[model samples]
Target: MSESKPGFRPAMTWLHSWAGLVLGLLLMTIWWTGTLSVFDKEIDRWMQPETRIAAPEQRISADAIVERVLTERPDGTLSSLLIYLPEERVPFYEVHAEFENAESYRGRLHPGTGEELGDEVSLAASGFLYPMHYRLHSGAVGYIAVALATFMMMVLLVTGVVIHRKIFTDFFTFRANRKSRRSTLDLHNVTGTIFLPFHFLICLSGFAIFAGWYASIPLSFVQLADPENRAVELFYAADNDAYYSREAAGEPAEMLAMAPMVAQAETIWRDRYGVEAKADRIDVTHYGDANAVVEVRRHFPSNRTEAHRDSINFDGATGAVLTNFEASPLRKTRTWLEGFHQVRFDHWPIRWLYLVAGLSGCVLIGTGFLFWAASRRRKEAAQPFKVRLVDTIAVGSITGLVLATGAFLVVNRVLPLDAAALGIERAGLEVRCFFYVWLLTFVHAAIRKQRAWMEQCRAIAVLAVSAVALNWLTTGDHLLAAIGKDLWPIVGVDLSLLSTALIAALAAGRLRSKMRQVEEAAVATHRRDMGSPSGAAGTVANRAE
Candidate 1:
């Protein structure tokens, strides 16, 4: 923290720049996807039109749904089943069950008719964006990479604060009209300063969410002491002893009516906890067995303190209450940290706020890249290979990601509904299109050099517009129609696409204007050189002398 130390600020500055630049693109991708995940359910609703069923007037019977699932699934296949009751955001009954051999099934059910809803088009907001944000869908390696990036982000944030002695003053110091490098630096400083606490917490909580994965040394010691995995059990221990014991009888019996069980759980919750508890989900284990257990998880109001801890279990066959479990204080603290990072209990306003904060983080990283490139422009001209390479990567990563995401949305809407029948998995195709387009953008950037930025911006604008159009052509749900129908998810997505188009278009225009200014300046400099004696006459005079 001592500014007087020789080379302290400069060393810290170098660390900040290199650290941010090295992983900036990956961080941007993670941040962008994480931002979208704030409203992932809404995106899922927009993507999977089959899931946009209307809420039922009367609650659907869970027993009937269970029967339906049993008939559809193979005999003795279901090991466990989870039923997510319909809510305002997700209006279709969702069933997720695990099979005997580790296979899983997920499908939606019509609320009133109790019929399975077939998805012709596979939309992947939840499957793609959410996983990509956290895991990159690459399993363990991706998890390690993301964790390392998150740790680096924390380092950059701390080093950034240490170097910026005028952090408070810089919060109000944005000079937009200055030279590009200076302006970019100012913006980076301002954003980093203003949202420092948020950026720190987001990074910390993100790492903390997977703390067990990263903090394996201590966990290994704990595991060594408790070979029975009691440490793990204690970490996730339930409030009641019955949570761990449910002896299934050899004889099978039909589950008791779910309506009564649900009513009983609600009554118990309200009477005991003084909170109106509506069942958010029902999870049944040992289904059809004599000692089958049904757990009804209640939807509590969005209180960060609660940490989503409200559930009552019942005897699936007898309709008798079993156990109610609440989180321990330690577990609740972990849940609260996770809730802060994931925003699971947040409403629309707070969700949007999280999105904006996430976007600002992206901006901070982006401006850092720009500042590094712009500052080195003149010095690197003699051997500009490294600078050009970084420039291409920066362009491809920042704008290419936007372009690729827009193309992904467009592909989702443009592909035929029965794409799987045509030998192409619809969801996989969308993901492939995204990465392919992104990879091509990198090639395009390398070829086009500085023009790549403006070109990709325009490309992104076109893609955004096409996505909106394709959504309308495929779904017959234009923005105006969606608004009229009060389908805010669709409306929000459409408006957001349009806004993205406008922003990209405007950026392209400004970049073009800047390119023109650079050309004019270069032409003037050439003319001045030729008109002066320094052109050919000065060379001839020097030779004669």
Candidate 2:
């Protein structure tokens, strides 16, 4: 076997294994967390019980919310504010207002409860968590990690295809109760093999998400212009919202009423696009000047969707049409791309599909970690404890993250809203709870035997189930109620959590049972070799002898 000689295929195999092993855990965390992030809004709904309002609550118009903000904080620079209209998925429109200063407060008022709606805005942990999968909080470092992990992922997919020669032939093969190596191989093959299409599409599209950064291998032409402008041109922004400076021709500024303006906007949208656009906010630029323009953007479908979408710009003085930025093929295409990558416009089916593919990616990376440990265990058994500790860390992070995320949802439902509101913001508190609990899981696993793996998995199972129950307790909204009310998202979220819990419970049970069987087999093998009747000291003495 000329060990010193380098071989072609062997070198490729080494490249594949090491590349995958190094980035495997990070990729798994990213994928798993990203999957949950699709339902981030629903998760927040489940978390903040007060956000759920009875059917009779007053409906606040987007114009009114804007007026209120302008009234109370006239000096505060409006960075961004989203007013969500009530719907089955999100039964209340959330008005999120942020000022220029980072120390500003954001509140989610009952879309119906207009002025002085003082409910504390809960931490959008799911919102924050989803983005962390790609761009973590550490500006450059976050993107760097995502960039490195993505590069490794692409390598893994390529090398994985290379190593598995019979990719299509073994697509449906799975052996659950076989030898450990065989079982691991089946896991690697089954999860990795079946989802090749999904893996390819998501990875390809994900790179496209940051196309301005990496897809530049071919777009050097654009780079020749300003490198930064290339990115801006791909994604667009308005020129400016500055008012046209001119004194109001103080003649009773005959202008369009709010209701009539909406009616006019709808007529314009329906005439051009054959559908009424959901008007979110109406902005009057240069309120009284001749250059004044009023813009109304559709707000009914969440900000993430692309349909029933249009924007109407009008002359403030004449109410005559200025411009329209909706229903255009080009605008719609951009909307679809943004919606596809973000799952912003997705219904339950596509959301679940994304979740499955994402989880499968996580599984694929997880198996790579197991394969690494299996390859190293024999050598590591002879080395110092630290070598084995690194192995434990790999296992701990992948499994512990699952456990922590499940626990965080459970806490979301159980923790008092007021507790989160005090001193620390609810969002920040929720994040702390997630990390602290996750940290605890790692600490427990590191100290306990490998058996801790099963214990922690069981904990995850319980926490997940608890999250479902907590949702019911807080919202009086069980899965049944959700379905009855046509709340597919609510039903989907709960059922998904329950399904995860059941899967964890089964996996943990199987793992524990198998570990017991392995321990028993070791005992029986020792007895046979020693030929001793005394099972305790006699067995030890035989091994010593």
Counted clashes in each candidate structure = 0, 4
Q: Give me the displacement of residue 20 in model 1, in angstroms.
A: 0.5
lDDT of 2 by residue, 59-152 (tens): 6666675667657776765433444445545555555665656434444545665544456545554566777777866676777688788777
Highest lDDT, which number? 1
Q: In candidate 1, where is summed lDDT lowest over 10 consecutive residues?
A: 536-545
lDDT measured at residue 435 in model 1 versus the true structure, 0 to 100: 94
Clashes of 2: 4
Give a tens-digit lDDT track for model 1, residues 135-205: 88899888988988999999999889888888876779999887767778898998888888999998888
Give each model a TM-score: 0.89, 0.77
Scanning candidate 2 in windows of ten residues, the lowest lDDT window is 236-245
How far in Å is the alpha carbon of 478 misplaced in model 1?
0.9
Candidate 1: which stretches are off by over 4 Å? Answer: 71-78, 98-104, 216-247, 267-274, 298-306, 420-424, 528-545
